[model samples]
Target: MKKYKYPSVLTIAGFDGSGGAGIQADIKTTSALGCFSTSVLTALPVQNTRGVRKIYPIPIEAVADQIRAILEDIVPDAIKIGMVHTPQLVETIVSTLSGYKKIPVVFDPVMVATSGHRLIEEETIKAITEKLFPIADVITPNMDEAAILADMKVVSLDDLYTAGKKIKQLGCKNILLKGGHQETPIITSLFYDEDGHYHSFESSKLNTNNTHGSGCTLSSAIAAYIAQGKTLYDAVSLGQQYIYQAIENGMDVQTGSGNGPLNHFFNPQKLIKNEMV
Candidate 1:
């Protein structure tokens, strides 16, 4: 008998029944990118494309057990973390992921929702900065989140670089500062690596509201590419391209009453397989 395995990515994220964001988005993105996905729910956010109403964060012990349960048996090739709501949750995740130092971790600091709702608790910021940042291979923060992390207003391209440097100084290996919130037709994202180098990626901002899960999709895409053995630079680059295409393809579709979701399956790939080593 022959055994086979598919590159797997574990998504530690919140739940969005709307299927536009959170764990749903992560799973869809990873699956579409040709990687198997496992998940650990960190929160239950009552949300839709319209907005977020309430968030119930899972207890730390429960989150820990969930992480251990899957991680112990089906170790993933990469991890994508999202929507950590409490300081204790951050500690729990950091401690567990610290054991798997070799796997690349993509941390998307999901502080606020697209509908102007705050997701994480206040104290979690300090814990995330001190404990979680060190373990993450890449941290992707939108402009608003970057401003909070950098402790200043991130208003321009220069602010992206400055804030990215400040974020890296907090022990993150690399930072991708997303500039989507800027009022420009061309959105630019800056990638600052550990070596103090900056790479910029730009995409024409599509005039559409069908971008509910874009962030989760991008971060998961990066992790999926990494799980498939792409270099960090290449993973980030490809992730951007994938997300832009998803958004472009989904622009006209309507899922809910408000902001819709990206078309994650616009170009789905067959799940890649390899013989178990």
Candidate 2:
């Protein structure tokens, strides 16, 4: 009898040695959400809670090989992309994943780190906007990233709406404009669908500094839920809830000297079994 496998998500991103963000966070979030996780490392960034020291981008060929090796065997049900630090890397990834258009892709435009370090070059940003954005099922960009992509400030809700619209014009089918950077009592994460409809997700802002991997975690959680057969709206909604709980659960726990990580396993679950087994 053929053994059934769990729903899986492939995360292509940088490697954060601190385990708070990047590939580590993606894997943790996907697993916590009950999906098998795979990864292709784009860059090896010497980073921690304090900040990013240096980034060693994996050779474009090596990056391509890693992705190809995984897709040829354990093709993921969904894909989550983050942190391509160069135009060459962006082009390589976009070209490689072009054949897998049917796979749902949740892309996090990780141009800058939480510690204010620029993780990507300007040319790389252009490559992502021109190539990856169009193919991605959805792109998750925070206020700062949105501003850079849309070429406008994203401090106000109106600004967020404008930025979301502008980014959508860049060719992405859907947009999730994260509102954590807004100085408001509530955090509002807006979801813009392909049909130009908007779904607003608002939650009470939890005051905490341990938000290092929040963006990466949320995007991966969204991918996991999508792989589990949830609708885009439901996936985003539930992913937000999961991230909120993770943040609330770890609000007090100290993990590092600077910004810390969320408790990814705050509510853990076993790998979903195949019912026919």
Candidate 3:
């Protein structure tokens, strides 16, 4: 018998008390995908399925220290970032990641909660757009977040294309415009690459309230698969399917009074740990 240590994936995001979204979902998705997951907390969210009650962001220096300390010991194959609630935090991450040139970054433009509450500050949007977007390998933005960043209402496929173009111009290598919030029977996710190519992935939309943490899960899944050597398109494609199955499987489970969490552990992977026999 032999043993091995799996490669690690890092998630920099906020903390959710309900364990539905943010870093919690990222960690869950990474672990379930057979990658060891590490995390740096960006914000402390007082929230449940009902909604976000309060948000307290970590100090910029502290955030930097956390990432620096983690990077020193483990160079993650890929990293997923979410919920940079302030301009300063966004700036700090940009500076820190810039120093480490090799890691692949998956940025989830997490701006709102599942219950329709804003998570990031209004003043920080510009910093994220100008600073982080340029550095990210991939940026995942849902309909609402895409609309906010693009400064327009994304109500249809036409609006989605416009939004994707607008975000692509911000310098992200790839933009995944998620269409979960649209009121339609089929969900269409749009991906625009740096080479001026567009891809649309469509799936049957599930009618359920357990859609919380889906964006985080999908982005983290992409990062996880990428860490294991999958191409960007293949990673995102499989990530979307993973998310769709998680949502479908969790549709029947009751987790809370409001929107429930996704089934992140739906298809678990066994880890081959390093050991001496």
- State TM-scores per candidate: 0.97, 0.97, 0.95
Model 3, residue 28: distance off in Å is: 0.5
Per-candidate clashes come to 0, 0, 0
Q: Estimate candidate 1's RMSD in Å.
A: 1.2
**What TM-score quantifies how close candidate 3 is to the native fold?**
0.95
Q: Model 2, range 55-96, lDDT digits (tens) per residue?
A: 986889999999999998988889999988888988899889
Q: Who is ahead in TM-score, 2 or 3?
A: 2
lDDT of candidates 1 onward, in order: 0.91, 0.90, 0.90
Which pairs of residues collide in model 3? none
CA deviation > 4 Å runs, candidate 2: 275-277
TM-score of 1: 0.97
In candidate 2, position 23 carries an lDDT of 98
**What lDDT does candidate 2 reach at residue 214?**
89
Tens-digit per-residue lDDT, 134-161, candidate 1? 8889999999899999999998888888
